[model samples]
Target: MKIVIISLLAISLHLTNSQITSGIVSDFVRTNLIGYPLIHEPKTWIFDPDVALKRRKQFVDLHGDKGEKLIERLGLGIDGNYEERLAEQRKRDEGHLGGLNAHLP
Candidate 1:
C-alpha cells in the first residue's frame, strides 16, 4: 500500500511538472508573438498570435531596442517594417509556388 501511494505520487508529480513546463513555454511564446510571426518564429503551434499580441506592450517596454533587434534577428518583427518585408517575401513565395506547381506530378 505504501509503495502504491509513492508510485502514484511520483507519477502525478511527473505529469504536473510536464504541464508546468509546457505552460511556461506557452507563456514565453505567447508574450513574444509580434516579434515572431508566421515565418519568423514558426512556433505558432506553441504560441498563438492572440496571446502574443495581448502582451505586446509589456514585451516592448521590457525588452526595448535590444528586444526589437533580437526579434528582427530571429526573423520576427519590430513593427511596420517587418510587415512590409513580409509582404514582399510573400509575393516572392507565391512566385516560387507557382513555378513549383508547374512541375508537380
Candidate 2:
C-alpha cells in the first residue's frame, strides 16, 4: 500500500516536470527561432494597412461621430480623412459606375 502510493506520487511529479519542460522548450523555439509568428485574423496595427482601413469603416459604421473620436484616440495610422475619402469614392461612383442610385426603379 505505501509502496503503491509512493510510486503514484513519483509518477505524478515526473509528469508535471515533463509538462513544464515542454512548455519552456516551446516558448524558447517560438521566441528565438520563430520570431513574431505570422499575421492572421482579427489583425493588429503593426503593419497591415488594409486591416486598419477596414476596421475604420466598421468602427465608423457602428459608432457614428463618436467613432472618429475613438479612432483618433487609438491612432490607427490611417490618413485621418475617412469622410473625405468616402465622399471621393461616392463621387467617382457617380461619375463612372452611375452611382448606387442607378439600380433604383
| Clash totals, every prediction | 0, 0
Q: List the global CA lDDT of all models.
A: 0.61, 0.61
Q: What is the lDDT of residue 29 in candidate 1?
A: 50
lDDT of 1 by residue, 15-83 (tens): 668777566555555565434354565443565769877888887777674585455445645664877
Q: 1-105 in candidate 2: lDDT tens per residue?
A: 686557555655676687775666566557765664553236656676688767876777776656655754444346787667666665677734434556565
Candidate 1 lDDT score relative to the true structure: 0.61
Candidate 1 residue runs with Cα over 4 Å from true position = 1-73, 98-105
Residues forming the 10-long window of minimal summed lDDT in candidate 2: 68-77
Candidate 1 local lDDT, residue 20: 73
Query: At residue 90, what lDDT does model 2 achieve?
Result: 58
List the candidates' TM-scores in order: 0.21, 0.22
